[model samples]
Structures are given as C-alpha cells and as structure tokens.
Target: MQNQWLVAYTSPKTEKKIYGRLLELDIDAFLPLQKVTRQWSDRKKVVEVPLFPNYLFVKITQQERWKVLSQRGVIKFLSHGGVPCSVPENQVRAIKDLICEQEVEIYGSSSLCKGERVVIVKGPLMGFEGFLTEKKGKMRLVVRLSSISQSISIEICESHVEKIYG
Candidate 1:
C-alpha cells in the first residue's frame, strides 16, 4: 500500500513522545522542531521544541492509520467527512524548510484567511502563489493547503507579486 503524509493531534506536550513511538513502530514520522532559548532563575538554556505544539505528522497507509491512532498520547488523525486526509507534499516540505529558518512566524487561521490571490513574479520564491496579506509593514504570501486545514505564510516583497486572473 502507498503511504501518504498525514497530521495527527497529540496530547499536550507529547509531540516528541509520539514521534518516538512511531519510529519504534517502523512508521515514518516527522515532528518539526525549532530552537528556542529559555531563561531560568539563574541560567539560560537552548532547547529544541516542537514547532507546532500538540501536532505531529506521519506517513502511513490506510491500513496503518489505526495503528497510529492507537499510540499513546495520540488523540486522532485530523480528518474531514470522517475520512483521514493527507497533507500535500509541498506543504509538508514547506514546514520542514521553515524549521531551519532562523526567523519565521506562525499566524492564526484568521490572519491570512482572505486577500487577493497573487503570484510571485521574482526572487527565490518566483512562481509561488497565494493570498497576499500585508501586516506590520511587511507583505506576506499566505498559502492555504487543505488536508492540514492550516495556512503557512511566507515573507515576500510587495513589488514581486502581481494579481492573477481567475
């Protein structure tokens, strides 16, 4: 059976634990982590924390879906119409890429929910298209992908995009 990338909702603060379990079960799993420094009373330490709190991604086939859900700390697969949905490969890659980025921001669903559809006409992200939303003096290209039911925003220059005809 073919496997597809899917998102799973996990118990609070158990993202890493679930990821490890999947690995033990020979299931392909990914938990994007970001480096953050925390300050204690007398010391500071750098730690890798889950980028998306309480969420984990796994590559599994339909027959293996139930196995993932049965893992401890795993709540359920993010689904629609009672069917588990697979996240687009490109969206998965974007999240993976963002984890290595030194500066990035994750916004709520409302922030980029509406705007004009635009395509990047220049720069490294040339040909990228999404809803363009301007915030805090910065222009962001927000791409909303189904399956995950989440939108990711990438910083872009206002001059690099032009409107697209339907």
Candidate 2:
C-alpha cells in the first residue's frame, strides 16, 4: 500500500512522548509546535507546545499501522464512521507553512461561523483556500482541517483574497 498521512489521537498530554517513540521506531511523524509565553507569579518564560493537543500526524503504509498502534500513549487513528480518515497533503503543507509565520492563531472548529470560501490571491500562502471570518473586528482567513475539526486562522488584507463563487 502507498504511504499516506494519518492523524493519531493520543492520550492527554502524551503527544511529545508518543512522537519521540514513533521517531525511534523510524516511523515518520509530525507534531506541530508553537512557542508561547507563559507567566508565572515570579517570572515569564517561553515554551514550545503542541499546536493540536493530543494529536499528531504519521506517514505510513497499511502494514505499518500496527507498529504505530503498538506505541504507548497512542489511542487510535482519527476515523470517520468506521474507516480511518486521511488528511490531504496540501492541507498538511499549509499548516506547516502557516505556523512558521507570525500572528497565526488556532481555533476549534466549533466557534467558526460559515463564511464565503476564498482563495489567497497574494502573499506567502497564495492558492490556500479557506473561509473568511470576522473575529474581534479583524479579517481572518481560516484554513480548516475537517478531519480533526481544527482551524488555523491568520490576519489578511481583504484585497489579498478573492472569493470563490459557484
């Protein structure tokens, strides 16, 4: 079977551990991390945290599924109905690229309102399509990963996007 990208739902707070184990097994895995500032009573510090809590991506063939499941802390692959759902490669690449840029925000799929579908006409994320939303009075282009029900939003100029009409 050809290798495909799959989302793994892991135990709470175990993403980093499972990612390491997957690496040791020579399995390809991706855990998107973001640097955030945390304030303590005494001081403030920056740390890298998982972009999607309790989730990570793995590239594997059908035969390697068992090897991934055998890892501790991994619950199971994200599935719809009874079959595993695979994420599109471009969506994965969009997430990877977006995270590297500043002023990016992550949102749960539940909070987003349905808006006009648009494609970025200009900018580093050109050709990326997502819903346009106004949140807190800022224009945001939201790229959603439907399989995981999560979205990555970034501020964009109105002129940078062109609405898609059916």
Candidate 3:
C-alpha cells in the first residue's frame, strides 16, 4: 500500500466536489488554496481559491486510479511522455509544509510592482531567501532568489509560485 500523489483534473469549479468524493472514499487529498482580498460592488471580502484551478491531489495506489477516474467531475491525471503523471509524496509533503508555515501574501496592486522578503524552498535554490525587485521599466516581478552579493533573478508572481508574502 505505497502512497502516491496523482494529479486529478476536474470540470471547471469541480475541485471541491472531487475533494469531497475523495474524502468519502477515505482517500488523502490536498488542494493548495490562495487567500485573496477582493472588492465587490458593495463590499470587500477575503476569499480562498485554488491556486491551480481545476486540479486536486489524491493519494492512492496505481490500481486504485481507475476508481477515481470513474468518479464524477474528474478529468484525469496529468501526463508527460504519454504516461499518466504521478506526483511525488515528498513534493506533496513539502507543499503541505508550506501551507502550514508560509506568510507570503499577494493582493491586487499597481501594475506589477516589487514585493519584499521572499523565502524559497526546493530546487538547487533550496533554502534561498531574498527581496523582490523589478527589472528596469518592466511589469514583471523578479525575486533575487539568492542575495545581493552574488545572486540570480527568477520571475515569480506570474509563474507557478506556491506562495507570496507581504
């Protein structure tokens, strides 16, 4: 009974439904949600939405994938090289760790500005931390993943960033 993470794609806005079904079947699942503050015609509100729309994580055996495959609202697992993709348990664990301890925040701002104090985890850049700065006259936000002395810039906020801070 080895544990594996599979990417489950669902119909638009069906993430919650898929999550519930997985839970009912006693499957472990994860969905990273982002907290956003939005303004409506009459008021402001804080909303939590999926970071990756139409996706959810399910922990199951390869033999059990077909059961989930037939579940309502499910599209299928992601694939590469023409094979179904299986996410690593460690990767899922790390994302869960971030969900537990991350403080990065993102909000609507003036046409793509810089942020401050980003903490990085994972990759050759593991344990990397730095401040974010904008490239001259560009709307893209860059985070100096290392530091000022000798560092490189990586584009964030427009990519698959797990989290952002205030």
Counted clashes in each candidate structure: 0, 0, 4
- Winner by TM-score: 2
- TM-score result, candidate 1: 0.70
Q: Tell me the lDDT of candidate 3.
A: 0.62
For model 1, residues 1-166, the per-residue Cα lDDT tens digits are 9889989999999999889889999999999887779999999999998867888999989999899989889999888898777887766776775555544332444323337788767654456578877678565678665557666667654566677877
RMSD of 2: 5.3
User: lDDT of candidate 2 vs native?
Assistant: 0.81
- lDDT (tens digit, per residue) of candidate 2 on 107-165: 33443334879888866667878997778865578877686888777776666677788
What ranking emerges by TM-score with the best candidate at the front? 2, 1, 3
Each candidate's lDDT (Cα)?
Answer: 0.76, 0.81, 0.62
Q: For model 1, state the Cα shift of residue 121 in Å.
A: 6.0
Name the runs in model 3 displaced over 4 angstroms.
Answer: 104-166
Q: Alpha-carbon error at 76 in model 1, in Å?
A: 0.5
TM-score to native of every candidate shown = 0.70, 0.79, 0.64
Reference-based lDDT, residue 106, model 2: 28
In terms of lDDT, the best-performing candidate is: 2
